[model samples]
Target: PETVTAFQLQKQGSEGSSGERALGQQEGYRVDESGKVYLPFIGEVQAAGKTVMELRQEISMKLIAFFPDATVQVRFLNFRVTLIGEVARPNAYIIPNEQLNILEAIGMAGDFTPYARRNSVMVMRERNHQREFVRVNTQDTTLFKSPVFYLKPNDIVYVEPLKAKQYATQGDFLSRYSPIFFPLVTLATFVLGLSVR
Candidate 1:
């Protein structure tokens, strides 16, 4: 879930005033599952497809009638991204600010794992009610200027594992069951040794 904070400011005097004071400390509005923000007098307003600036403008226009000098500053409270697959820590992170590059997000996940494929990193993003996938190469310098370089809210970074890692996992499965098969072979060898003696 995402939330927005609206900072309301009002001019001091009815006439032109150079000074302004905050109406309150801060007013937080939670974007519900339906993607709408509920205001005091405005009821529910759709906040999903709108940017922070747009939401601010909409809210300011709605409140202008009640508070003539009202001005609003809207900002998203949480910027979340998920790192999965071959990263050191496969988990979701809440970024402190809105601007976060792909490398920075990877660093927050403790970098990639030993088996991570640096050339084939995948970024899954959801924008404007649609999901999209992008491939980024960590080793390439061009990644810096890529459109997908900057991550957005609810973005997912997936680092693919190398072939060696997949083979090692298969080897592990056999190793886990080897003890059960090993004992039977050892018993047959012991019986053959006794018969030969």
Candidate 2:
């Protein structure tokens, strides 16, 4: 899926020429299941197997005959990442630009929580219809050299919580009844003070 914008440059002395006019607004082009994107004048172009830059060049070359002074810009609008688990916020984020690194993706999710196990971060990816999972330690400097360090579209990053977080929840029984327990304790203390006075 990509967004293609075509701008027609106008001459300085041209009357009624409003600088540049957009060809068809900011239209979003989605590649069909067969991996082709259909444009108005250019018909269908193979997009699935090609990068945004390649598609832009192909489109620009094709549009030369129609509008010689037209400038074409292509961008992937569907590039997204999923961040879950121990991060401060867990959600799917649509990145405006295609370029994204692991650290930037994590930062977008408000970074990892205090209980997050930074040493064990997992990235899930899909390749050739097969799922691939990779584990990397954020504390390890070697992670910079890992190929998975850079995130791809639809990649999922999961941060596991430390054992202490689990134990804290399980061992703290009062947390579940705080609403009633706090009121009862306050009433009991008030009654005892009145009797002593």
Candidate 3:
């Protein structure tokens, strides 16, 4: 069951009601570990493992006792994604809206670095307490149709570094030590020259 962040209650004729008012507005309501969200007048409703529409309907039904003319709208406020490994700025980002795609997530992370393997981007997701992994290739036109292309809340995108990046890092390490190695070699060469003389 997904968590519920906030809900909107539209009272048909309530005072000061300008269309709809966000119910449980302050910080929004979080579905407790017990898989329930407490509404103002409806008490608690099972929210976990249910879609926004399903929860909305449930809340609407519960509200029939209090406000028969009320309409409810529910949504998730904690929808987020994590971008890591070879991206320009890898971090977890909260999505204001539900709809998110792999490209948009990557872009939010400042796009992939030059070392990133564009053809082997990995997406890790968890569902029903089970984890799954999928690879995507941004270079392929078919990737747009892949199910993993649309990222889910808490989805992790990892851009693997290219082999060239590994070699380049190794080369950088050697270059940093080159100044120390250079002086030693020059001193050794001078000593050898005097010994030969």
Candidate 4:
């Protein structure tokens, strides 16, 4: 409110414009052959392997040196995560924001089916330029603390199946072994009706 002067007012929205061109971003842009981006102020930030937050902070620091008294906003203009393996819809979803989590991803895939193994969910993430694997068990309530609970940009979630699903499916092939064939409750009801008759 104190910036009544025209000079101070100009700084309100100016993003430290140093005549740099706005960069085009994609939904998790593929690393260029050089594995980098020619950012406005930060130059070629090591983006291919860094997380969004890491890149943001690095750019913020670099911008501070140049802007001095300005504010900068860094964001992954486009990002996504892939959910595959047994999910109803196994595809890459553009994560418009960072609020997405494991449950949210599963929800996006139409939730889990009876065949899905809630305990065998897996996530693939990159850390320090190295790929890492993590497991998630939706049946377990403590999954909130599991490292894989959060879906990062480009994370892949896989929902496996339990053996019981296959075994139960097998019984359907044989009439005598059919899981729906033997209902003792039906026999008990029949006998009770006979007595009533």
**3 versus 4: better lDDT goes to:** 3
lDDT of 2 by residue, 78-174 (tens): 5768889999978777666658889888888889999999999999999888999999999999889988998887899999999999988875867
C-alpha lDDT values of all predictions = 0.78, 0.79, 0.79, 0.67
lDDT score for candidate 4 against the true structure? 0.67
lDDT of 4 by residue, 1-197 (tens): 33323113111211115321122322322346565766544567677667668877776788787667655444554356777777787766665465678998888877887788888899999776799998878888989998777777678788887787778767656656545555766787899999999
* Candidate 3 TM-score over all chains jointly: 0.76
Q: Across residues 89-147, which tens digit of lDDT does each residue of candidate 3 receive?
A: 78776665658899988887889899999999999999888999999999999999998
Q: TM-score winner among the candidates?
A: 3
- What are the TM-scores, per candidate, against the unseen true structure? 0.66, 0.73, 0.76, 0.57
Candidate 1 lDDT, 1-197, residue by residue in tens: 12222333232222124222112133256789889978776778899888878888999899888678876767655466788899887877655454889998888788989999999999999876788999999999999988889988888899999999989999998799889878989999999999999
Q: Roughly what TM-score does model 1 have, to 2 decimal places?
A: 0.66
